[model samples]
Target: MTNPTVAELIARSNRLGADPANTNYAGGNTSAKGTETDPVTGEPVELLWVKGSGGDLGTLKPEGLAALRLDRLRALVDVYPGVEREDEMVAAFDYCLHGKGGAAPSIDTAMHGLVDAAHVDHLHPDSGIAIATAADGEELTGKIFGDKVVWVPWRRPGFQLGLDIAAIKRAHPAAIGCILGGHGITAWGDTSDEAEQNSLWIITTAQAYIDEHGTAAPFGAVRPGFEVLPEAERHAKAAALAATIRGLASTDKPMVGHYTDSAAVLEFLASEKAPALAELGTSCPDHFLRTKVKPMLLDLPADASVEASIARLIQLHEQYRADYAAYYQRHADDASPAMRGADPLIVLVPGVGMFSYGANKQTARVAGEFYVNAINVMRGAEALSSYRPIPESEKFRIEYWALEEAKLQRIPKAKTHQGRIAFVTGAASGIGKATAARLAAEGACVVIADLDLEKAQAAAAELGNTDVAIGVAANVADADGVQAAIDATLLAFGGIDLVVNNAGLSLSKPLLETTEKDWDLQHDVMAKGSFLVSRAAAKPLIEQGMGGDIIYISSKNSVFAGPNNIAYSATKADQAHQVRLLAVELGAHGVRVNGINPDGVVRGSGIFAGGWGAQRAATYGIKEEDLGQFYANRTILGREVVPSNVADAVYVLTGPELSRTTGLHVPVDSGVAAAFLR
Candidate 1:
């Protein structure tokens, strides 16, 4: 029989994880005790299904729950003192796994399992944690929750912590939950709803108390508003700033940087006491492992040029790296752990909002989300009293703890473009969307720049709505629009590593029949637009000093003849020559320029959407019934080319396969004779 308790636990865990105020990323866990029939004996067994390690509560599923034999887990509590004393309890939980496939349960599983309640929720809501870790946390927890909540001081999480929790439970049998001073909170109930209610009750009560009487961040300076610029200018300035962060934090490969300058974020950054507030460390302890204790702080000058500011930022980052190394050495214990990566995940840029860096957008987004939450909790803590988090030594313990460190270290390797960024023009549809999707799949952040902002955003969401794909309103023919698009890409993902010049409009008409308007439009988009976008992107690629790619989306018509296609052919011809010329020039700057000539990619493509394809198929003498297959059979390979086929060809040119082969023209038309590079 399906245990309703487990399903309820999963539902409640997701609810808590969904709210950043409740949990950030995969920080909390939920568990339920229920009788599940054993497959072998067909008898009910006492099992504990707890939230598995690294499983975020908001997205928790039944499969994500780890099942353990509660009887076996409890039995090992007494054997720990006689055994090695270290890891015996943790090992017992691992050994009691009902079957394989489920992730190892969190270190708190034993602690949760020891709870007698039918349901439990362990959360680290920011506001609640702000009160729990407050200087008068223990006293305040009692003052607010009274006998409803028990107070437990900070204790290292492990077998010993489990025992401590069990003892607390014996004394506070009537208490709904316990607030761990300088840590988190735990709630229990007869049902999952009750357990979640207890957790929410504690959080709401603490937050209410803090709101009613909290203190501001302690700084002996007046609050000052930062210099606010218009939206376009602010994001442009933010892009320039993000580029520097990427350069500073990256050791071997550059980290992708993301900027946030929302009103709330900017207000937090502009606070005169912001620097001191950032130094106090994260509002929650778990973030110590994610963002470190404090962020890398920078005071960006208003009058400084982007170049000079970047130079200064790099210099400051050098000193910051050394200081971090010294901090590690100062805290080194007999274990003598090797220094962790020195890259600062969070960077506080005064006058602008904070910038976050990660190998990819997902990681950066998580860090950014937590930092914003920390801002809220810190402000609340400031209002109630001076915000106090775990000490640096304790953070060191959490950061370097064997269990936590082990959890982070054992993971999959990076993809080829793990930290790289890509920008695709006309990415709202057709081959461009396919290209952006491919790049995102390979771990490169993608920017979808198209003429239609709404469609671009929709396409980006289709690719992945996780902020990895950014959408911009771009008119490739307009210089300012193209510049804004580039700026949007930079603001969203630090810098551009690949620029696919695929934004073009086609008009198939004979030289004599082509109207002047049609001729100019085709030329402006296919030829002039490519030049403008490539030129705009060249500056940043050169500034980053990182080798990049500039691939033009040419057509088979550039080399082959097509009836009544003079405008399309001429524009494409210009593209082919432009690629060869750009390859020669950009090659010196370590940017490899290439082109993909695709033929007859009709389905779901801009060219076929009531434009050139329909006209060409109508003009052809072949029967209308077989127009779609006309070009497919005309090709030597007799295969219909799709957007993905062109995308794959473009990837080959930009990826490692053709690193030494620039000025290359790849034919993605399943073997074209006349379109072959001569």
Candidate 2:
């Protein structure tokens, strides 16, 4: 039988975690105590169920809870080795499982199990953290909550801190929760509902107090030269600087990126106090872990030219890296894990916005979100009292902790396309859509660009939405449209690693019957479009200093000299030659240019469905429905080619298997001997 307590705990966690104000993502834990029948002995046993390590409360499930025997957990108190060897306690948790533990116990498990309350919640709410991080947090707690909440001074979260909180609870019988100095808040209740209400009250009350008492300028006055830029200009500047910033951030490894000009971010960056606050770094461990100890702030004024800003950024990054290495050296001991990397994860620019980087897009975006939480915390802290966080030494201890290193080691190996961003033109349907799906499945962040914005967004949504994919409208034939699409890609994912030039249409008329308009339109969309996309993407690819892939979806008609396909065949030929031309020109920069020559991709094909199938069937003297089989039967392998076939060819060419091969055309036409490269 399921324990009702665990179910209620899940509900409470979801309610708290669903709102950003309640806590930053995955930054808290919740627990419930209940009795369950042991399957082995048929004995009633008390168990503690708490949110497991690395689980996000908002999306938490039954499996996300770690179930431990309450008696066994409390027994460890007698053998507690003190704070210095606290990490070893984490290993001992495996022995305390109620049955097969539901999930791995987190460091916070001690706090939940040792407390007397039936339900408990530990949260990193921005408002609560604001009060918790204030310089006079103890004094502020008394002023705000009176006897309802008590103050617990700074202590790294471990077995000792858990014991301290338990002692605090016993001492203050009337206290429902306590604010941990330089951290967040912890609340408790005899019932699940009471626990949730207590947590919410603490959060809302802190916010209310700050609202009433906080000064008008929490972050100090907006600096004269750092005012937020106009919206259009702000975004344009962000797009322009994205590539250079991304390149600098990827100093350690290739990273996917995210850009935000949110009001909070813009306001903070434009304020006079931002530099000092950012330097103090974040108070909460969760904040600095994702955002790094602190962000690298650009010193240039908001109105500085892009070139000048980029130039200064180059110099600043070198200093930031050096300073980070020195800090690591200052704190690292013989036992500490190696320095992870010197690169900054979050970068702040006054007047523009913030850019964050990680191995993937979600990680990057979340880092940026965490920084915003920090920003809010700082705002409230400054308003209520002078902002004060834990010392730099404490932050260094948490950043390089051995237990944290173990967690990092447990993350699954990266997929083949991980950290790579792919841009697919005309990706809303047909071969382009199939290609986008394949790339995304293999862990590439995809941009589905098409003439139809609605279909493009729908396609992107199917591939996991903004986390791993985004949709953009691009009329590839127009230079402006193509450039805009490229800029959007940069803003969304930092830099491009792959470009698939697949946007095209066909007109199956003979040279004599093909109108001049038909010739120009086909050439404009295929030949000219491919060139424009390639040209626009090349600059960023080169600027990023990372090798890239450019694959063209040319047709078999490019080489087969097929009848009644003059306009389409010529455009494809133009694309095929571009592969060779660009391969030579870009080889020096490690950018590979390749082409996929597919024959008669009829089923589920946008071009075929849009009248090309009927026109081709008429020209071939065959029924439109039998055109696929007709083309298949003519091939040596007698296999009908589909969009996925072309997609497979694309994956193969860009994949590691063909890393050294470029300027080559691979056929997906089931043995088209005539179309085979000679």
Candidate 3:
């Protein structure tokens, strides 16, 4: 129906919004004009239901559609043309809202309301944006879409631009859509489905034309002979760079990584033409909005030390912000609002993969994904003679547009631990995993450091919030490995707010049966690993100057004597002492050191996995099924100690309740008389 209802419109919007290939992350909006009964007045009213600003259409619902009187919105067109104050124009849009506190209608609301169609879809598809941004974009669009699409020149998106679009529609009554040069495209139809398909057809048709005659990435393919470092080495280098850039950029809102270390990324970074082409603007205006006009590029020495790389990165970041300020001043006029934050969302290192940063991991990841897709779009445009992005002036206008700025300004402040970054060792499973998951739930971005990189990633994915959790590989006992893990934490999340030393293993043998290898393994993980990780994390904690937490997951064996567990008991005792010493040493810097001594946690425990469960059962002359019950009954509270229970105790040590308590131990063993803290 040409007069589509709001439900029909929302369904159509979600269909278009669901495909990121069709629209960037929440970058596009949609609208439909229909009739509805005014709830209060009981009269038929014509309304425009447009996608709410900041709400992604793919996930949009009816509530996300800001309803406004269609006639009232169209009437503003005549008045807005002469209005000098953009604030007054914004008030007009706000006044027309039929749903209070609903998403402010998109900046394109006026344009949508003016179009003579039952349904409208506006998006920045990858190929479509490339064509829109080309130097000969308007002429090329005419050739590809023929009579179906018209060309609309760029004007800051507002009442005036909407008027311009409406004029094109009036002149070309048969046109299905129009390309907004240097911005994006808009399509409309009598039916919602037709509108969306029209948008896609234009993109597909434009791409086919490029395939026949357009230039391919003119910079040439990534240089074949360049010295690309090993994958592990490149990851480490990228981690260092991400950490340094995040350190420089983060303040109250610490940046978290949506890090990608793929082969394609490495190729781009290693390209001989990177230093030149990378400096150019983004492939599409929406891409620019997410990644910023251009990434902050850092060129590290081929053999630079981690410390050297970080130092240079900080210096370069300072220059980048300064340049951003100058660029704003060059294009900003009296009407321009205060400059947006100068921190670069994308960081490009010459020989390493790109890193995307945001207030949280989700935003960072989405931005990172867009940048990756933009990479291909840019290459395509480059191949077609040369990729010509919009000028700096147009880029500035869109970036600082009131509507876009409002989206960011509306971001709710982080939770108590929202900006805090935590590194949890041995986070692949059991208590480590539980603790990591809990910390993320409470708002801390968590770095899962474990020997098994693959398992660690799986655990992070299970956490299901990509922006708040990341997995890194490291053997905590190795000094270099510990440092690398710490760097990964910094890379994934800009700073270290807490460190959880929960990685340890045991052979479960008596002193007489303990081999040198078994003893070494026990002491290396329980004692040495804790010592090294704490020492490595200390530098960044001290530098952050905001105070931090270091938690050691010790065991009841650290204090209570146990048969057939000498190596674990002895090494863990040393680990407990280390915590006390660190608490005393680091307390002055706002750092807190504590330990969680847990016992009888049989279910879902990494320590209980393998043949150890059967062995422990046999030690007590009981079947494996009875072992759990026996241990649960042995505790004074007669309760089972689960991984989540231990995780809760760890939180107590790190949370606000015990801020004044350090060098302390919380027993999460359901109450062991012999293992009492006293």
Candidate 4:
């Protein structure tokens, strides 16, 4: 028997969606444009056509199919700002569609553009959606596909989404395709038939799972019971909840707006659910990854004061952070530092649903969706049996799995100066000297900016590579000197890659005894110097395209108010805030700004030798040597974290390895703060 042709398979796939109810208009579309471009020929090529937008696969037509230039589409994989330049991108689509004139490209044009396969097919399979919509979908997915399929959790579809898909394709070149959780499935093949078959296989597999597990009764039927409050009372209750959530979230994004007059949601909230509605995540884990596992739950009696209720909520959040830290440590092995790090999970309100938080928008959205899904699954599972989530230990393992850790690990290692020039303030000794050495080791051409020209040059000579290291003497607090230093850096190495705002003086004086002169002097060297240097380097870093990294070496005292070091601590705190604001502003441009709060990086210069250390040690009733040991012993790790430890952290953030991380204040104080308080 002759094999079915591409036309036959396309027809078969279309026929399978013939039922009008199954193929809702505008709900599903198919396209036959093989919109991939050949890298070598630079000519139009056709492999397999796809269904155009708004055309149901059930009745797709040849005219509905846009025959595309495969090579041209492939070329788009490497495009930048992806679809942020929609006009140009859409115009390219127009050219791809028309040759001279073709049918408009599918709405999933970017999706098709990213795939390298000759034939591609996409569908919002109902069964697939049903399965994806479940809370434990990931577990169910594992049970169903085992290791056969790759699952991409829900992500907003567009340019970035396409980039993510392209990355996945590159990583799993052999994957038949992928299932986008909470969205749909994508199947690609050497031939159109195989792609369609894979799509069918995924849908049928999901259908089989649904048949075995049974469908959830409509929410209205299984909905838990709750008191129907008066409209005025409901409004008051919701307002209180919203205020609590906003206070915890530090955002006013109308989280509680969705719950106003929402009795069904309110019922879910006020129910006697085991996990408590606030503790349950959103519809999916993706949401949890962003909003966290819970939101602030305000369960005070109606007569309770709002201020008091808020205080209780803050206390709850503290407890949540503590619990999460304990949970992380309980399951994490000794091997991974990442496992030991603290990340905000979910914030929960007693009578409200959870809200997740993450480092960025994409992560936040994923967390929200995941939370919603998790809630739905847990509620549904309750009907079948007890809704037992995976053991906390298991959740911890999954959360901190080596594979996930690997994703965090994949950050680009700081490249050897890859067009990045760095200016290290106070580069002669202590943490500044170590930072300069670390940056040089990572390939950044270094400019040792210091007050002492001789010592700076000596430090540069010690680095040994004259080609990569240059020494310059300048008072960082002087605006003109900073400008000159920046100019010199540009002349030596085309552009600046990083700046170590590590120059500062630590004065030990009680707040009452700190003279105005002393305060101003401390600020001049630390805060003013940082501002001057950063202002000078900003333009060049922005122009470099590859975002720049700035590391402000702050102090643990910034977070914890330490006696007799008020001047030094206040400036460090301001520096940390400066980095935070910088991160928020510079993030859009790819530049990352963060701080390293090191406790006691012993080894030469700065506060340690300036008599300040001895004074601080005396005040604390300990000798200088004992002060270092005291801090080390006060940490969870019980290791004396050296200047190199702090330097390594700076390198991690500014280097390639932590490209996605920014606006973070990493404590390199051997977890001293964690030991002392939170």
Lowest-sum lDDT 10-residue window in model 1: 216-225
Q: What is the C-alpha lDDT of each candidate?
A: 0.79, 0.93, 0.78, 0.61
Best by TM-score: 2
TM values, all candidates: 0.92, 0.99, 0.83, 0.39
**Best-performing candidate as measured by lDDT:** 2
Question: lDDT, candidate 4, residue 602?
Answer: 55
Error of 3 at 163 (Å): 2.1
lDDT, candidate 3, equals: 0.78
lDDT of 3 at 289: 82
Question: In candidate 3, where is summed lDDT lowest over 10 consecutive residues?
Answer: 217-226
Per-residue CA lDDT of model 2 for 238-313, tens digit only, reads 8888888888999888888999899999999999999999899998999999999989999878999989998999
Question: Candidate 4 lDDT, tens digit per residue, 377-445?
Answer: 444444333343333453454356453455456556535444345789988888888888987776666
Backbone clashes for every candidate come to 8, 0, 9, 75
Writing each residue's lDDT as its tens digit, candidate 1 over 90-119 gives 666788888667768778887788877788
Over 4 Å off, model 4: 1-418, 674-678
Candidate 1 stretches greater than 4 Å from native = 81-88, 216-232, 301-308, 332-340, 561-564, 618-620, 623-628
TM-score of candidate 3 against the unseen true structure: 0.83
